[model samples]
Target chain A: MSEAVQLRRRLLLLTPLGVAAAGGVAFLAMLRGMQSGNFDPRGVPSPLVGRRIPDFSLPAQPPDGVGFGSADLLAAGRPVLVNFFASWCVPCVLEAPVLMQLKEAGVPIWGVAYKDQPDAAAQFLRANGDPYARLARDEPGRVAIDFGVYGVPESYFVDRSGIVRWRWAGGLSADTVSQELQPLLRKYA
Target chain B: MRTLLLLLLLAGPAWAVSSPSEMLPDRAQEQRAERIGEQLRCLVCQNQSIEDSEADLARDLRGIVRSRVVAGDSDRQVIAWMQARYGDFVRLDPPFRPLTWLLWSSPVLALAVGAGAVLAGRRRHAAPAPLSDAERARLADLL
Candidate 1:
């Protein structure tokens, strides 16, 4: 074979290996993103975002009180934050103070206790300092399923029009409040 | 004896992974539920099918599948209901839509690339060009 053909042959032999190396490099970059908290492996983008809120009617947590539903949100004159949390979720404990901060800002926050007993959720709210204006129990988690919630401490921002404008899959950080939530709250307001 | 004991231990966890996701009393309906459950992905345990997952969501999904089957929903309808609520991610078998076209065709692309590389790497091994008259006279003198 001529030198050009031989060189071409060698390069052709290395093409698959080159492709594999590129894939490996891309995979390592993804791992780095995960480590730096820039990417979440568990974050599945909520399909409910950019769409109307799903239909749901859960009972008042601890029984004997009025619980919020989709109609309640649609009737609201402004944006509201819908939070799905559980008493057993550790991240919810960390997030309680941030939620209280939002509550103090006069942001209307609705809480759904996901898959937890009504009594436990009521006690948890009592212990954590209740920041919710209207609280409900998603005892069967059917409401949560409808909302595409896979885990606890998920949140959604619904506009006055009942459109879910934003979704956060994990615990809300201070940055998420100031950066993501605050901007959407203003835009929709 | 040790190998037999090890096999027995392995079988224990294997059986534990899937424990009769059937809730229907009717044998055929229960089997149908089982089949449908296997196609549903557990949102919590993303890798495992609902039938194989013990996650709470998986149990709920299995129950939903069985209820749908019991209510006379076709298998397609049952799967579609889940896909509606949870989006296409709820199904283990991704549908061949625009979003998943690359994922579905990547193997064929890889196969084509591999075949091209293999074909290109083959040596031609063609016969050499004939020697000139000067090279023939030199050969004669050397002989």
Candidate 2:
């Protein structure tokens, strides 16, 4: 075959190989990003870590409109555990009973229903046995955003001084509550 | 349930009060998130943005963008924060760092090399003006 024709044929074969190589590199890049947690679904913590909670208030949901705010929970003479949940979230369902147990033990708990209909939130609480000291509705998810919540079923451990002590992103099991939460409570309890 | 649904529909008009953000803050931050998000690579989708993607990870990233804004971080700072945590892979247009210099330079380098080879081959094949006709005839007689 002529050299030019041979070169053309070789070029055709090399083009697809080059494309595949580029694709492989891109795939590896994507896999690496996932593993590193940069693209994490739960919003990452900011340098605001050691800072006090922001100031805001939500009109408490019906059956309780206690004007809950940063001070109501923080100034009440006890460290607070604020659980951000949604009636639509399944993990929240699992964590509900555990929270009820905490409530039974007299651990003060607050609920922030994220982007949920208030009536649905009320019904869920009633059916599952309300564990919240007072419920706040974040109908537009503003409060949750302000709190840096990544998704439903996140819990924040705030100390008596109103500083956020720790953040839990997923479902809270008894083990986590005992090992992680209870210790924080002991410090401020 | 039915009663709340009716209330929600009635409240639809009032949704305008909050602007149906479906997210925190408002349009300015949402638009900024989308702009920044489009530049971010979704870990799950691997090709889409957390803003454009519906994957759980993307949704999380979207929340992260809003959270950063609420935390009083600037757009550049938020992007830098993600880059630090996730590395260049999380950014669609990752900065030109030492590690990525190779990735960004290879294609252009390859094209230049290929062009050089093609030109060199052409030059090698070009006739250096043939020996004069007299020189050609004398060479033929010696053969």
Candidate 3:
């Protein structure tokens, strides 16, 4: 056979090999990215993804202080709202007025001051106007950990049985309160 | 009596408690570790934040993060250090740079090319080829 014919045959064999090599590289790149926890298109679901609340205890904030433990959370004979907040958290500030409204409307609300100073928490409540039935200071944030708090200003609607009914992350507005919060509250009621 | 004393001396090391430093992470170090963990990716796990992964490497990385923080590195510095050591593969959200530009853009480019090829194939099949005169004559003969 001529040199050109031989070259053509080699090219035909190499083309598929080149394509296969490129495809393998892409696959390995994706695998490596995922293994490195680097920008995965599909991330892991949290262990607290669909679980109930873990046990928690909180110290009472003074001036109408009540021990707001898990048992107190269930004592209301109604579902309770546990708002994880800190005075420094902006989203918590944003949701404060909405929580006040809920409190005024006879909704059971409690506050867990996550990883905050007791005095600072009290002052925050004084300034924002406390809407919580009980103010519980979580000094080391152990309660917040039990609640799976990734960030502050997260709210959990817990049923009378102490099971978490719904969780709202991020800032809460009137729309969220009306649309999502009320529906869950009604179900518990 | 001498044998009992020798046994007590040997067992003393076993009974000794690990220092708080050796056991639990210090507050400042723990906080730094957590921040670093959220930013880092687990190399052996899929899409898991280094803070959340149970893999052995992840634990080691967490310890490294804490040590770095204790050594007076800022959060940004710690992350930058990881990126330097791991080549941006340790970050869950990598910065958009020339090296990673293809990784980010390749999927959309592939999709666009695939769609174009499919549309072109459909258009070619949709159009009819004109019959030659000999084919028309054959059809006429058949009729």
Candidate 4:
């Protein structure tokens, strides 16, 4: 073949290989991206972040006999952690101690018992130790939908201005509390 | 008789499961909700759309879609609201955005590259210049 034809043939031969290599690199980058925890499938980012908490008036948990409303979030005059949990959620059971620790540290934690029967939620708190300064019932899960909750054991850190600063889904362990939750709490507080 | 009664009691709540259709107030709204639901991925089920999923979260999403439709939100607005709350992962057919451009286009790109390679190979091996007349004559004589 002529020199130009030979070069054309080589170029054509390498084109697919180059495309494949580029594709492989892209695939690897995606895998690495997922591994870095930016795209965690378990936790979807809430659109409510940096926005005011959705207006809600949920019935308070038993023993308190007082309901929590939107104004309560702002009246605190300090950042508060709102935790969404359910009696049926196993992870919520696991996260109970971490919430208790936050409460012990004087972090005002508001609990939203999502889609749980009042008696069952009360029993759960009785068994696991209530970490909530105030607890509310999210029956029909309307408040959860308003908050854009996907599953149980989710927590949101609302700033003093009633704007949600950070949200974490899934169970909270001691490590996550100290490393992730507390730092944001300190920042907002 | 006692065992049969116990079995009947165990199955008593089986009939209580209600179809999602019952939540909608009208047929048009239900159809609209279903169309939107089919486009939304059920976050709990991961692989199924909200319309096809039996999960509680899917049910809630379906209700939300129906309520939005009834409240006069257009289909596009409802979908946009969901996408905003749930991120791009909530849509089965993800939009062709900067982040998903590769995901949506890579297959077509691969096919084009394959076709190019095959066409180049065919050209490189093109039928031996159609065998010159003299060569054809010789081959016929040899045969």
Error of 1 at A27 (Å): 2.8
Q: Tell me the tens digit of each residue's lDDT in model 1 across A75-130.
A: 98889999999999999999999999999999999999999988888888889888
lDDT, model 2: 0.75
The sequence of per-residue lDDT tens digits that candidate 3 reaches over residues B67-139 is 7788888988988766643446678887789978998999999999999979976985796667889889999
Ten-residue segment with the worst summed lDDT in candidate 2 chain B?
Answer: B12-21
Q: What is the C-alpha lDDT of each candidate?
A: 0.85, 0.75, 0.73, 0.85
State the lDDT at B134 in candidate 1.
86
Task: Report the lDDT tens digits of candidate 2 across residue range B1-143.
Answer: 99989888886453311224546657787666667777877755667666667665466677777787777788788888666444466777868879789889999999999999899779867866568898899999999
After superposition, the stretches of candidate 2 with alpha carbons farther than 4 Å from their true spots are A1-48, B1-34, B40-48, B55-143
Better candidate by TM-score, 3 or 4: 4
Interface RMSDs of all predictions? 1.6, 6.8, 12.4, 1.7
Best by TM-score: 1
Candidate 1 CAPRI classification by DockQ: acceptable
Clashes of each: 0, 0, 2, 0
Candidate 4 accuracy as TM-score: 0.74
* Complex DockQ, candidate 3: 0.04
The two-chain DockQ for each candidate, comma-separated, is 0.45, 0.07, 0.04, 0.47
Instruction: Give fnat, all candidates.
Output: 0.42, 0.00, 0.04, 0.65
A135 in model 1: Cα distance from truth in Å?
1.1
The number of residue pairs in model 4 that clash at the backbone is 0
